[model samples]
Target: MIRIEPRQSSSALMTYGIPVLSAIISLLLASIPLTFSGAPIGASYFEMFKGVFGSKFAFSEMLTRATPLIFTGLAVALAFRARLWNIGAEGQLYLGAMAAVAVGTGVFDVPGVILIPMIMVMGCVAGATGMAVPTLLKTKFGADEVVTTLLLNFIILIFLQYMLEGPFKDPMGLGWPQSSPILDQGMLPPLMDRMRIHSGLIIALICAITAQFMLARSVWGLKLRAIGENPSAARHAGIRVNRTLMSAAIISGALAGMAGVSEVAGLKGYLTSDLSPGFGYTGIVVAMLAGLSPLGVVAAAIFIASVFVGADSMSRAMGVSSYLADLVVSTSLLCVLVGGFVARFKFVRLIQKKEVTQ
Candidate 1:
């Protein structure tokens, strides 16, 4: 007979080591698909690395891709830390982008100093409102937040589509499904002379640092961790579990909303239905890869961004499908999940003997 047993204490080394090991294993597994596709596994990987880090332009583009991921990853990380399965970050991101578009398209004619902050705040508010429904459903009606949030994502996507095809559609775009271009004042200024990287990167870094500080040094963070570990025990200890969870949900949503804002104001300069290439969904993987650490999220996001950017280069150079990047990412996520499980528990063969007294 075989039995699964939880370890009394998990190894600290394994806890951190699993992510790296999983990544390596994922790469090895990914080589199978590469071979089947008639691509040189080693060469493909080499090209990917060279594309991401070999040139200044490539590095800048990678940073731009990492920017929004940082926000989305932080959003997922914060909620997961509180044991809240907030899966509506995708919806929240779209709503945020919508709000930013509304504000950036001369909803107000303020200067950049005022307009920029206004757009960001509006985006954050929109995101928070999107999450409010799921939070309330879970807190007041005993509904599952996971279902509510995930469903909300589809709903928001449809809503965004409706807006873009109707009220927010740009007449100058020749019937394209996109919003009007953001005015200069509402746009994020580029960080470099030639690169498209913008101030959003700074904002993402600041948010990550702030989140890390809150999680590590604040009383509220302590309460949140306590609640995540055991809500019943936390309630018995006089903690307001519902309120804290609600706060977490709102903050998480707000962070995700910022990702949308960053994309519209910093990169595309306009809102579109396809502004995100599944950044919100990918963020769950990023957060997990970071072990839910806010600071670690930065590194994880950069690494993920590099994979996608490099994959694009590889595809262009080696006649491979760009979907290979998605495959590797998905495989890495699976490896991380399995590695975490193995790290936490062990399987043992149980020896049994017939009862002699019978």
Candidate 2:
């Protein structure tokens, strides 16, 4: 009989190695599509590498793109750690971007020093509001947060379209549905002269560090972990499961909201319908690939961003669609999930010989 057995010891190396292995497998699978498309696979991959890290500027750009990814990845990771599936980060991102625009342009007229921080706060608040719906339903009404959070994504997308077409659309944009330009003071300080890199990258890194600290050293984090493992047991132990979940959900939303603000205020200098390019959705993949580790999420975010930045060059040089980047991310994530099954459970088959005797 064929059987599957768990490893005798769950090594940290194996825990981390899965992502690397899955990435290799994903790359191999991606090549099949490129081959079918009659593309020069080697040159395409080479161009992708060059585009993401060939030069100092390219690496800087990759970091810039990774900022929001890290934030959203952390958002998903934090919630998942609490055993809460927060799938509305995409909607939260849009809401946060919208709030940043409103506060940046409508209520601010200070120097960059003041305006940037204020806009960031606004964005975080907006994101928290988006998350509150699911949290409230789960905590108060005993509804399933996963379903509500997932459905809210579509609702938020519709709201984004409505705002872009009606209230926020710039009249001088030649009928393009885009927001008015943000005030000059609202733009994030560039990390270096002549680079699109911004302080947002620093913010993401710091946030990741903070999350690591909390999860590793804080009492609150212990309570969260307990609740995640067994809510009934946690409650019996006086952990206050509902409160822990609420806090985690709010924190997750705030992080995702910051991601939206970073993209709008730091990169685009204004809100737009395409503010995210699905960064929040991409973050879910990042969280899964990282095994819900905050530190792992940071590394995963950078790797995913590399794929995106590289795909652009691949497309230009090899005439392939950049959307293939998404395929890389999706495939790797699936492999990660499949690889985890071995860590969590064992499978075995039993043999029977009674039929011949009968």
How many backbone clashes does every candidate have? 0, 0
The candidate that achieves the highest TM-score relative to the unseen native structure: 1
Off by over 4 Å in 1: 1-5, 8-12, 346-358
- Indicate the residue-level lDDT of 184 in model 2: 79
lDDT of 2 by residue, 30-143 (tens): 898899778988887889899987999999989998999999999999999989899989999988889888878756688888888898898998898888779989889988
Total residue pair clashes for candidate 2: 0
For residues 107-178, write the lDDT of model 1, one tens digit per residue.
Answer: 798899999999999999999888877999999999999999999999999999999999899989899999
Looking at model 1, residue 255 earns an lDDT score of: 97
The reply for model 2, stretches above 4 Å from the true place, is 6-9, 345-358
**How far is 334's C-alpha from truth in model 1 (Å)?**
1.2
Instruction: List per-prediction Cα lDDT, in the order shown.
Output: 0.91, 0.88
* Candidate 1 vs. true structure, TM-score: 0.94
